[model samples]
Target: MRQLVRAAHIGPSLAVVALATLLAIADGLPAQRVLLVALAVLAGQLSVGWSNDLLDEARDRAVGRSDKPLASDAVARRTVLVACVLAVVAVVALSFACGWAAGAVHLAAVASAWGYNLGVKSTVWSWAPYAFSFGGLVVFVSLADSPPQWPPWWLPVVGALLGVAAHLLNVLPDLDDDERTGVRGLPHRLGARLIPRVAAAVLLAATLLLALGAGIGHPASLVGLAVVVVLTAAVLLGRGRVPFVAAVLIALTDVVLLLAAT
Candidate 1:
């Protein structure tokens, strides 16, 4: 059980679930609708984590990451397969309950996640996975009612930027192992010296978008931008542990925005 939990990357998966739930609430979804949205997000997140572990099983073993359930032989391959299938089923079921637009977003999320696990994560456009995955979440939330409006378009723009920053930050710890194993994603292509700069740029763009969105009267939009600016400054100043801390801060900002908006 422990191994399975770890393999699912439960912490980050839950964080994504929380973010999706918040997004749903911010869009003024009903309680039942919000629950369905959260369920779909949770299942999608678990699917991503499980797929990552399954696809990178060999590489993880080669890197001596025996702490992983599969690498340590603590969980059977069939068990993992079953778990992935169940998660996907839950996502699909929840999407159907929500509506066709939500169902389509759910499918997009699953496809993007699978694409990332299969090979897109090792390419120069690795950030594509984050864009598609998070954008799907935004679409799901927006479509909970009527067709999405363009005035709130900055929401997805900020989300995509934050997602890309997350992708880069996530790859930081795995750079050496990834390169040794031929998994040179966008982060690897950019090199270490450039990571902070790229992170800064992404956060900056997100902040600008949020500020513009706020100027147009979306007060809740500035929450994430303020958090990103402070966090980006910390990262740029050479605080080694700031990236991980910033991630939590970013998540918190999303929570705050949701609370305020809802």
Candidate 2:
């Protein structure tokens, strides 16, 4: 049971729900609608998380990854695999409860994640899942309204770029392990040292685009952008924890701006 919980990647899944809920609240969704959308997001994320651990069980074991419950034999692969299947069902059902268009978009996000686990994670297109999954999320939440409205143009763009940045950061610490396991995504093609800079640059681009798309009168966003620039510069000058810290800082800035813009 403990291992099963661990395999769910609860922290990240909850973060997804939190973000989706924030979007729902920003859009003034009814409490029931917000809950439904949040539930759907949670289920999809659970499927993604479980499937990732199940698919990577062998590779993780190969790399002796103690952090992975499956790799460490703390959870049976079959158990996690079953959870993935069940969560996927919940995702589909709950998504349709939101509406057809919203359901389709959320399902595409979930499918993109499964596609990544099934084969795409090893290809150059590894970034696609993150982009679509995240991009679709805001769209899904926005559409949960009684009369759905299109999300602003900047919403999905920032989401996609953040997705790319996340992919880079996530793969960085595991580059060597992933290489050993025969995983060669875009980050691999870019090499280790360059991944940090690229990730920072993408995040920086997201902030600038958000600020520009929303107009310049908002000094708060401009201040956030400035903070991102400083963090990016610091990351470029150093190594180790700086990149991760910078990513977190930029993400926090993004959350504030995202709520404001949406």
lDDT of each: 0.75, 0.87
User: Which digits, one per residue and each the tens of the lDDT, describe model 2 over residues 159-253?
Assistant: 88877887887778889999999999999999877887888888888899889877766887788888888988877887777767777677778
Query: Estimated TM-score per prediction?
Result: 0.88, 0.95
Q: What are the runs in model 1 whose C-alpha is more than 4 Å off?
A: 146-151, 216-231, 242-262
TM-score of 2: 0.95
lDDT tens string, model 1, 108-200?
877897899899988998999897777667767777654542226767766777788778877877899899889988999988767766877
- Candidate 2 residues lying further than 4 Å off, grouped into runs, are none
Top candidate on TM-score is 2
